[model samples]
Target: MILTVTLNTALDITYRTAALIPHTTHRVTEVVERPGGKGLNVARVLSALGHETVVTGFAGGRTGDVLRELLGAGATARPADGRHGRRGRPRPVDALLPISGSTRRTIAVVDTATGDTTQLNEPGPTVSAAEWTAFLSCYDRLVPGAEAVALCGSLPPGIHVGAYAELIRRARAAGVPVLLDTSGEPLRRGVAARPDLVKPNADELALLTGSRDPLRAAHDTRRRGAHAVIASLGPDGILAATPDGLWRAAPPAPARGNPTGAGDSAVAGILSGLVERLPWPTRLSRAVALSTATVLSPVAGEFDATAYEELLPRIRVTEHPAP
Candidate 1:
């Protein structure tokens, strides 16, 4: 089972407009809302692949209520009784924990003409030390059943920058592998704790390592204490660095659809591969295939089975030359 932790979860609202311009009211051509947060997206993909997944994070407010009512139905708390649920049969655990402040919402305006997205993100609900203490028990209880725990997305206001580092330490103590995914200061701080894996998009990779090339940045990030680093390269695919070697995994060709949540979907593939004890090269190839399938899907966080199956056999995983 894969346990996904989203410290800062939100309801993602996507709008399509003919043209996106600042400070102008434009009629939206379409709109869709989903349980938004990196870990949540990872869990969604895992669930689609028949993996037993449990999701945990800080969710609150009416928006949070909507997410809980929808996404929460799928998560069941780890049993105090101590037994792993069989694969494909997930307990609908309310992995959704409530907080006093409302959860945040992110809006993405997609240009109808070019499919470019302009994102506006809220800072997220401010958390308190007291709330952190409350959730610590939840983390402790869930970590044991977790084969792989993915700590993803940004921290809500008032949550310490080293929050993920603490979680990583706890998971490590319990003999569980952890995957860290976030950005900016939080990511910089979390890397010092030595997560098993960290997946950063190209821009985030460049920012963290100060290298213009993603493959170089991925290798640099691996030196920062992650056992491995996977740099999601959008249409160009993924750049991965493992102890054995570095490789670039790309889909055979562009599938052409919504790119949103592709990186999160890739994270799911990597975690799934980890549980199956697949080779690093297999992990990278599956990640890229899942990411490409996600892009081919109309909905974010969703991958078409047909497309995924088609791409999986064709995803090109090539070794990188030494830097």
Candidate 2:
């Protein structure tokens, strides 16, 4: 099973309006809520793709209860393809450790007229020392059975900055490949742990390496420690630096819709491909396609399956020789 760790799990709430005008009252057209956090989003996408996934992290209080309820119930509606929770395929296993502090909530407001998304995120609840220790115990048990482990998202308040780094080391010791998706100091330290892969967007990449150039920043990041770095360039696509080779992959065209969970979808794509033992180029293609499809999907954490299939072959993947 693929294990995903979301230290700060959340209830993702999305609101849709005809148009978003500053300081003006508007009627809400739609509202959708689901379990969220970087890792939870990845687990959902992985489950949708027919992979056995296990999610573990902090979940407590009322919001945590609702989040876990949704996860347990599975997807509200099954897709036509019947991949997610269909034919007895496993849904994401909930192994979340409860905490005293309440889980956080994230809001995404979509302007349907302009196809823009504005996000409001609350800093997740503070984790206690005891909670952290409990989680580590759970993680230790989960790591041995996991084919891969994803240490994702922000560290909730009260957790040390080096948390991801510690997790990376533990996963590495177990010989399980790990993918880290986080930013700021946690990212700086986690990269130094030499995770199997690191996925950072352009701004995060620039901040981490102090370089705006994608290739230069990616190379610098790898030098700091990651075995491979796949930098997300938003609509421009992805730039990857790995021991096997370097490559750039992009969708045939920019997709228009909510892009809330696009990066997590990309993480899911790469992890799934890695477990399946696909080549770098193929994995990158899947990542880009899934990312773009997530952008086209109306719901957060959901990808347009049809668009993904159509865009896979058309994605442009050009290899670059190591400098």
Specify the highest-TM-score model's number: 2
Tens-digit lDDT string for candidate 2 (58-164): 99899999999998988443456653334666699999999999999998888988767788998899999999999999999999999999999999999999999
Measured with C-alpha atoms, the lDDT of residue 222 in candidate 1 is: 80
* Candidate-wise lDDT, in order: 0.84, 0.92
lDDT of 1: 0.84
lDDT of 1 by residue, 87-153 (tens): 5554324586889999988998889898888899987998889888888889999999989999998
The alpha-carbon RMSD values of the candidates against the true structure, listed in the order shown, are 5.7, 1.9
Pairs clashing within candidate 2: none
The lDDT of model 2 is 0.92
* Local error of candidate 2 at residue 76 (angstroms): 4.8
What TM-scores do the predictions have? 0.89, 0.95
- Cα shift from native, residue 127, model 1 (Å): 0.6
